[model samples]
Target: MPDVEDLFVEFETAAATTFRPPGVADVQRRIRGRRRRRGLLAGLLAVALAGPASALAVAHRADRPEPRPTPSVSPSPTGRLAVRTVTLPGVSGELAELRFVSARAGWALFDTCAGADESAAGCRRTVARTVDGGVTWQRSALPAVPDGRVHLLPVDAGTLAVMTRVGYLVTMDGGNSFASHPFDAPQAAVRRVFATPSGLYLGCPPDGVPTTCDRQRVLRVSGGLHFHQPPVTLRSDAENALVEGADGRLWLTVGDDDGLTVVTSADQGATWQEMPSVPRAARQLVLAPDGRDVWLVRTEQPNGVWRLAGTGWQPGPALPDDTDGIAAPGAGLLVVTSAYGGLGFVTGGGYVEVSELRGPLRTSDPGTSVSVLPDGTVVAQHGRTWFLGVGRGVDRSWLQLS
Candidate 1:
């Protein structure tokens, strides 16, 4: 495991910074739900250095048969960024989460229950990972991370935790050694878990329960594995995302059958308030270049893009119907719509196409995943596979990563 200072220095020394956009964009794109634990998240940084030419060798502890990965690695000429694909041998589709600790080290968790609740019949589960910058992969059996949706968060360079149906699955040495930490709350089922820049959090009462009627509260989970509710109430209606910006400000979107509610918490999740100027139907929010301003989308019927202004959410521009892939990194927003394949950014109150999506995507599959690495690498799911766009602006060439 890399030490704290080592993680910082390694990540900071990178010529290309890691990009972490809003969580809503992640959810909209159906990729990993959380990103950016700051210092704790250093491993996910895509180091500018090219990876080892030889494939890394990883073997499971036991004689258990492990899945094989065919990693394609290549170097670039001079100033270009090298891109490669890591094929997860046993991953048969239901890709739940991908937590790339670095350009080389990454962890992935998969559960094919397909949105089943905690009480439903279990599904196939596997925890696959790469230690040498995705150069090679070794997979082993995973404990029931039965949430259908799981979140992998790095506690440090070598340690990462997964929130699942049973409890928290923790690994101390990359993704090898494992420990189970239960939610030490009464009745303790977690609907959602969030890894903020400061700490970890859980949405109480779990999912499959009546999210609208049941009590939904945000509980702070400590490093000691204890769960304590925040001084605030959080709705766990499957759409809420606690969006934290570079300045540490947080915007929470809690929605249900009734309507939507947006709250802001300045000091992490200790307390909250009904933040005005945000939509009641907003499923996600992101900070703008100014840091004070925020942008949101309804994502429901009559979907629209809005910006916060003067104590209220004002309509900014018309969102292309069925927009999903969302990545907002201050400079602007990178978004994709279902109808026109308009993969663009919000500019001067309207969406401007930045790159033409290079895939045959169906009209209904408004891709629910988007990722921006610190080095300005943009990742979006075109269909079952992922496409990477390099560099800082609209001049992006796409590369497919499986």
Candidate 2:
């Protein structure tokens, strides 16, 4: 206590080394040490910032629930996905088929039962047109009532063809007048019909005549006026699939008791080549948007889809149900599960749930089919409710068109 300052100075001198200015090397070393300390601090800060997210992920994994069933008619969460309702003028009852050749021009096939009995026998199958993006519709009368199922295949904004059981009707003047064309093959042998820019293709009896009547041939009708049999033939009498890829290559898949046979025609069915045989009996064939990958819907596993790559068939994504229809809307793959599940957007070989479309609309009923327009607009119908999927990415929404 008597010599406190002197004692402190003595203690400092005992512990401290000789006082000298640090050199450039020492300064560099000190800076490097500071940089290391900063890096360590930054890493610690990152970990601290990520703690909540990591915990959330772990909690989510632990508390994850089973996949929910397709939602019923209920309001969606506020601001999660936007929904808009459209008014269809002069159009009522259930829309069976919807086809759009352009963004603004489209047609809808519906059963008109206004002021009549609700039975199918009382209802009349009718076709309607919308030239202003479905804002308004003009009902047109068909030349004859279809005895069975019919399909509307639009060739252009003005020219459209409707395939009925007996034959097909072509309207080159926007439903002003329809010209009927009967099938060259017997009505029973005409199983399916496909349309391309060139004309129509039909799955009918081989050579348009029946001998053994166990085989089918791909019938091409150029200009919708004549029937020409392509070179390719199928051994299956049950059913066959004919699809035109984006590259104008036609792929046909035939399933029989043995297995499946695949054939491709690059020259509009002028010439054909058989591809490697597929073991699974595929019930349907779907061409990818790129026109190279071919998808086969197997009869064994109806919900499962197989992708044909270079030379082999690999397992692709299994859809929500067998009723789901796959469509490429120029944004990504979309699976129209409206018949069983709701709408599913396909991503990374799986489904990214968009919306169940269960908002008091009948978009989830059976017999609903989905089709993508030429402008990438996805459309579907279930009962009288129609859904239009507009926008892309995050802005995409399933709008209910009444």
> lDDT by residue for model 1 over 267-358, one digit each (tens)?
66556667664444454454442245466655455555677775677776655554544545446553443433435554555555543342
Error of 2 at 250 (Å): 1.5
Q: Indicate the residue-level lDDT of 52 in model 1.
A: 13
> Residue 44 deviation, candidate 2, in Å?
73
Weakest ten-residue segment in model 1 by summed lDDT:
53-62
Predicted structure with the largest TM-score when compared to the true one: 2
lDDT of 2 by residue, 228-327 (tens): 3544464432224455645677665554445456677777776777776545455445554335556555423334556767666777665554333445
Residue 109 alpha-carbon offset, candidate 1, angstroms: 5.3
In order of appearance, the predictions have TM-scores of 0.56, 0.60
Candidate lDDT (C-alpha), each: 0.43, 0.45
Candidate 2, residue 200: the lDDT equals: 35
